[model samples]
Target: MSWEQIIFYLFAALAVIFAFLTVTRRNAVHAALCLIFCFFFIAGTFVVLNAELLAAVQVLVYAGGVVGLMLYVIMLVRGEDASQVKQALGQKIIAAFISVLLVIQIGSIVYLSFAGKATGRLAQEMARYGNTESIGTLLYTKYIFPFEVASVLLLAAMVGAIVLAKNKLER
Candidate 1:
C-alpha cells in the first residue's frame, strides 16, 4: 500500500478513537481535548482526500473555534466533576442499539465502495475544475444561504458569549 493510504487509515482510526474517548471521558477538560484531537484528525483525513479547503475549514472552524469555545465554557464552571456518567439500563440498551446500527451502516458503505458501487464523481469534477474552485463555486452559487446562515449563527454565538461574560463581571 502507498504511504498516503496508510496515513489516511491511521488518521481515520485515530479520529474515531479520539471521538469515542471524547464522549467516554469523565473529565470535562480531557473530553474537550480529545474532541479537539478528533477534529484535527478528521481534518487530516480531509487533507488526504485532497479537499484542502474543507480541511482548513474543519481545522479552523471546528478544532479552533468550536473546541476553543467548549474549553472556555468548561473553564467557566467551578468544580471538577470527575464522576463517571451513569446511564440507566434502558438508555444503555438504546445507545448500544444505535451504535450497532451506525457500525453496520459504515460497514455497508465500505463494502459497496470496494465493490465499485459507490464510486464518487469527485474525480470527474476535479478533472473539470480544481478542488478549491469547485468547492467555492458550490459554496457561493448553491449553498450561499446556508453558508451565510452559519456565519450569522456563529456571530450571534460570539456576541452572546461576550454579553454573558460582561454580565458575570457586572454581578
Candidate 2:
C-alpha cells in the first residue's frame, strides 16, 4: 500500500481502539481521555483524506472544546454518584448488537466504494468548487436545517451537563 494508505489505516485503527476504550472504561476521566485521543486520531484520518479543515475542526471542537467541557463536568460530579452507576446487562447486549450493525454497515460502504459503486459526483464537485467552498455551500444551503438543529442540540447538551453538575454539587 501507498504511504498515505498506510498512514490512514494506522490512524483509523488507533481511532477505533481509542473509541472502544472510551466506551468501555469505568472511570469517567479515563474515558474522556480516551475520547480525546480518539478525536485526535480521527483528525489525523481526515488529514490523510485531504480534508484539513475537517481535521482542524475535529481537533478544536471535539478534542479541545467538547472533551474539555466533558472533563469539567466529570470533575464536578461527586465521586459517590459517579461510582454508583453501573451498566445493566440489557444495555450491554443492546450495545453489542448496535456495534455489530455498525460494523456491517461500514463494511458494506467500504465494499461498495472499492467496487466502484460509489458516485463520482462528490469528487467532481470538490474538484470544481474546492473542498472548503463546496462544504460551505452545502452546509449553508442544502443542509442548513440539519446544521442548525445540530448546533441547537449541542447547546442543549451543554446546558444539560451544567444542570446535572449543579444538581450533584447541591446534593
Worst 10-residue lDDT window, candidate 2: 116-125
TM-score of each: 0.74, 0.68
* Pairs of residues clashing in candidate 1: none
Candidate 1 local lDDT, residue 5: 77
lDDT of 1: 0.84
* lDDT (tens digit, per residue) of candidate 2 on 13-47: 99999999988887889899999999999999887
Report the number of the highest-lDDT candidate. 1
In candidate 2, stretches whose alpha carbon ends up further than 4 angstroms from where it belongs are 79-81, 84-87, 105-171
Query: What's each prediction's clash count?
Result: 0, 0
How far does residue 73 in candidate 2 sit from its true spot (Å)? 0.8
- The reply for model 1, stretches above 4 Å from the true place, is 82-90, 109-114, 117-129, 155-171
lDDT of all predictions? 0.84, 0.84
